[model samples]
Target: MEKKQLFRNSVFILFFLCAAFTVSAQVRVSDFRYIDNIEGYWTMKTKLGLYAEKWKRVDDHTWKGRTMRLQNGDSSKVDDMRLFLEGDGIYFTIAAVRDSVGEPIRFKLRVLKAVGFVAENLQSPYPQKITYRWKDTKHMDAHFEGKDGRVSREIIIQYTRQ
Candidate 1:
């Protein structure tokens, strides 16, 4: 009976540890920032064109984001997004709908490339990967890549803390 009790206790502890690890792996949305800083409205300019967006933290590992073309200045309808922080790196996903009525219409936004030995490079990174990069406390660059591989652009956004 004692052996059985010990085995059951071990199983309970293992389960508890697994739960803790799972929770820790998830990044909260509220902590979303470019690089590791620069939060709030951002503007990005790329070879394609200019775009702007408002990034607001919704939770610890989640953020509410909206991107608009510079010409129209109208917000794109984004459904949801998830943020993850890896070792020395941050990643996020923006649920974008490419077409009005297409199946499997959602695409992911991820950090594909990191340029610069220092985070303060003035020239924007190439081949848009993540939507935002923290160049410094006051400067950031927002990047957007399309799902179809037909459209990809980068925007250099400078910001001030509100």
Candidate 2:
């Protein structure tokens, strides 16, 4: 009986320690400014094509952004986007690009940091996970990954801040 009790106690302590470590390791709301810091013009060159992105700070809690395809130094706007930090998390919204702005689809932020973060939309088909990570002081990577059933795809675009 004594041996059984000691075993239970050890398991409880181990569980408690693990929980504490996990809580401490997770990113918090205070670290939600990852998108805010990247407010500027960025361009990426990939085998697919050359892409351009521009970020504008709308407010302390919001940012306006746009992604475009560049050909012969001319830009064709692709997606109109927004980043918002509110409540206990952050979100990304997509409204419009060319003609008319429609309803904004919001993707909730699941990861947060001062310089890197991740947001996800389970309802989206293409990019279910949007992660922004810094590769160096001047280079940043915007990664998009998702799995539709058994098919999974990922795209990583490295941006040089301008």
Model 2 C-alpha RMSD to native? 5.0
Per-prediction backbone clash count: 14, 0
- Candidate 2 TM-score versus the reference: 0.73
Residue 68 local lDDT, model 1: 59
lDDT of each: 0.46, 0.77
Candidate 2, 1-162: lDDT as tens digits: 999999999999999999878754565666655666677888888776789788899888888889999877676888888888778767877664121334666677766776677777787766678888876667888888888667999988889987
- Number of the top TM-score candidate: 2
Q: Give the poorly placed runs of model 1, Cα more than 4 Å off.
A: 1-38, 45-50, 70-91, 97-131, 144-162
Q: lDDT by residue for model 1 over 1-162, one digit each (tens)?
A: 999999999999999999878645444333334323433666656565555566666655454566555544544543444444445444444455323444322223222223211111112223324445555655665444333354454434544343
Which TM-score value belongs to model 1? 0.39
- Global lDDT for candidate 1? 0.46
RMSD of each: 12.8, 5.0
Segments in model 2 whose C-alpha atoms lie over 4 Å from true places: 1-27, 47-49, 96-102
* Poorest lDDT segment (10 consecutive residues) of candidate 1: 115-124
Q: Model 2: clashing residue pairs?
A: none
